[model samples]
Target: MTFRDVVALWLVKEKRATDVVLAACDLLVAGEGGEAVARLAALTRLEADIEVPILLPEVMRELDLPHHSRGTVEGREEGLRAMAVRVLSGELTPRELTKWTHRMFGHEDEGWRLSELDDAYDTQAVDSDEALDAEVMAEVRRITS
Candidate 1:
């Protein structure tokens, strides 16, 4: 699908505040010439107050990609073009992109520390309610003390 078509689909399917944010991120990362720019412009007109983060680094890591140094404009353009191609070709879905982004940037509870917490919370780790309560009490004490 064309870039605009994908954005439209996303809007219709998701229809949340975050969907707009995701669409803008996709457009900026894709950098598919004027069309992507145009969509961003339209979105800006619709909601001039929204905040957009510079998520290039997160996007790059999610795509198992790299960033272009600021020394070369050409390199930056090339990286954006590669990102655009991946998004447009359906090689990367927005949800997958978002998840990868969260994991890469530590936005989600999937990092090493969070994973350790999950492991600790597993049934095998705590054999009874008393153990769980003790763990929680210890954490509470650590935080308050």
Candidate 2:
């Protein structure tokens, strides 16, 4: 399938702000503008209450887009890496990673895919706790290392 088709599918299926943000990030990274920007704008209009702010500061400045923190459900590894960087840099908490990872677990191969993290991805417990956070952090360490 085409990249746009994949993104369109993600928008239709997930319709989450994170998905939009991640798609926008991918567009920015690929140097796609004009039609891409229009597509994202159209997406924001179609999806109610989606956070339109871009996540990466550099991308925001370069693209002149709004700023916010947020992903696709194929970019799983990239999403994990981004979250891991945030966790290691004190920008994101372990609890947050745990939550995001669990959410992403549902979209494997549809929105995103993972090999290294596939087995360990959804291993996080349902309950939130320090120990759970630690488990997530260990997973983060694995991603980063």
Candidate 3:
């Protein structure tokens, strides 16, 4: 595999390990060794990126990152804004942008994002969610008239 893919894989693994260790520490702090063991065992069965926000301060400390950092959030918002611009410019397809938005932001409403773009361009909404409603309304009027 390429260096980029390998680096991504390593980061994923590191995050999972950190999560598992943090989980154990949490349970131990609560005086639940048995629960810790059980939870740790279950975690070993799954390959996932789990994050406990309350434990993140410690994790950030270990990583030499500030506990309360806005740079990351601001950077992410800028990235999404850039992606929106690309979609509007046809540099990225709507389908691809929708997928990326969902992956990046977890359930961001794509139609709403597209609507923002339509407004920005002073154009009619393209590929609108109202297509079905408009068609159904047309049929209803036809039947009534």
lDDT of 1 at 35: 41
| TM-scores for the candidates | 0.21, 0.38, 0.28
* Residue 139 of model 2, lDDT score: 69
Best by lDDT: 2
lDDT of every predicted structure (CA atoms)? 0.38, 0.50, 0.40
Candidate that scores best on TM-score = 2
TM-score of 2: 0.38
Provide the lDDT at 130 for model 1: 51
Score residue 43 of candidate 1 by CA lDDT. 49
Better TM-score candidate (1, 3): 3
lDDT of 2 by residue, 1-145 (tens): 2233233333334335545555664675677755435445455444624434332344345456433333443345544555666678897786666556556665455212232233344463354455556666676777778
Give the per-residue lDDT digits (tens) of candidate 3, residues 13-102.
322344445455555566654532344424432332343333344544443433432235433443444454444555666545444544
Candidate 3, which segments miss by more than 4 Å at Cα? 1-71, 108-145
Task: Please report, as a residue range, the 10-residue window in candidate 2 with the lowest summed lDDT.
Answer: 110-119
Pairs of colliding residues, candidate 2: 18-71, 73-111, 73-112, 74-111, 74-112
Could you arrange the candidates by TM-score from highest to lowest?
A: 2, 3, 1
Q: Which of the two candidates, 1 or 2, achieves a greater TM-score against the reference? A: 2
